[model samples]
Target: MSDYKAFRVELKDKIAHVAINRPDKFNAMNADFWTEIVDIFRWVDETDEVRVVVLSGVGKHFSAGIDLGMLAAGTHKYGKDVGRNAELQRRVILKLQGSINAVDNCRKPVLAAIQGYCLGGGIDLITACDMRYATVDAQLSIREVDMGLAADIGTLQRLPRIIGDGLARELAYTARTINGEEARSIGLVNRTYADHDALQAGVLEIAQEIAGKSPIAVRGTKRMLDYMRDHSIDDGLEYIATWNAAMLQSEDLRIAMTAFMNKQKPEFAD
Candidate 1:
């Protein structure tokens, strides 16, 4: 993967390891961040060589959310003209939301490994991932409320379905920070390690395991899970049946069954 101003990307053994690289600024989202993230996920979706992705941060923190300076500059472009300002703000919000949604919409499963502070937009980023793991000392917060604005990106929408309405509402209302343990307890993160080193190692192992699977089956499963989140049980069941009708015919199925009989690992093609 080419170098990005706001991220570090490394592709290995069908797994893409992507880390927010702006450590000096706590990896804060700036102008480059919004566009680069969208580009990265779009590339992931188009690359058949990649089967899974691991997202994390470099240095001390995951992210401190949007850079206050960047936020100010972007918003300041529209003056106090109520009509034009509102329309411009709406467009910017939609663009930001679309970038975050790309992570959720990617066909490959995304696992986020968070450490240090994951606040505001950072929380929005992780909630979009398929699974989240964090360092035990990490601090997470839904901090937009503290800034006098509701989270307009995705935390308000996706987080409620993640940790339930009561807990999600409490976080949004209070803007209180939660440690990794509390995050795990609330089902925000799947697991927590003692430190950043352990967090990265643990997440990489899981990513490797997922990357080893049949890409077709893995992608199909991710698609179904996303679909089921919005539909009823009956609808989900019918959708999966129709999905399998086409996907079950893949050569990977034969490779897997034959591997089982021979007690060998299955080698699947993209």
Candidate 2:
């Protein structure tokens, strides 16, 4: 709803298209990106009309990772006390983590449509999404090792879970770039498209299909999947049982059943 400096958001047919707007610098992440993303995703979470989100960049490349200038400026501020400086830097890291967590924690599914360069912090960003699709030539890397620092963002934690620990380690240790085909082979991205236009269209088609489903059912499904990640099989079953006890009573269920009997499409209210 509000204007954002780092992203351009458009909502239509219950799908939010959240695109990184800084194309000139290859859609690099700057100071505004870290802050505005939190605001944008929070809006996406609170807005009930939004059923799904398609995240992409408005450029030839997805992102070149954190802007080097911003990274340098952040390190320039230090106090005389070494412990105090460490505390300050720790807080900064936590703030950045919260930005990426916004996407991971959103109730609605966020699908990333990556193209070209998705390096360093870009890896952190996409790893947090519910699903990822990319152009065949999109180059993805865990680049912090080359920058003289380990990745402190969500990548190290989430990537291993997405692609398994062994391959995740190889990428992090070597800082090697992987194209879309290899990414799919490793299960990093769900699929690959021939080019940027096809990637956008394909991802948006998936988003639109998801948008047409019952919002309550979709949100419940996402909640269950997220819950299962840290919970045991027994716990997940119990949780879903409790969840459906209430959700199953919604009018959407009755509408869906009636539509099935009559051979008509069901329309759910926002």
lDDT of 2 by residue, 1-270 (tens): 988898999999899999999999888899999999999999999999999999999989999998899988987799699999999999999999999999999999999999999999999999999999999999999999999999998999999999999999999999999999999999999999999999999999999989988899999999999998899999999999999999999999998889999999889988
- For all predicted structures, in order, the TM-scores are 0.98, 0.98
24-142 per-residue lDDT for model 1 (tens digits): 99999998899999999999999999999999999999999998998888766878789999899899999999999999999999999999999999999999999999988999999
Steric clash pairs (candidate 1): none
Runs of candidate 2 exceeding 4 Å displacement: none
Clash tally, candidates in order: 0, 0
Task: Give me the runs in candidate 1 sitting further than 4 Å from their true place.
Answer: none
- Score residue 257 of candidate 1 by CA lDDT: 94
Q: Model 1 Cα displacement at 221 (Å)?
A: 0.5
**How many Å off is the CA of 243 in candidate 2?**
1.0
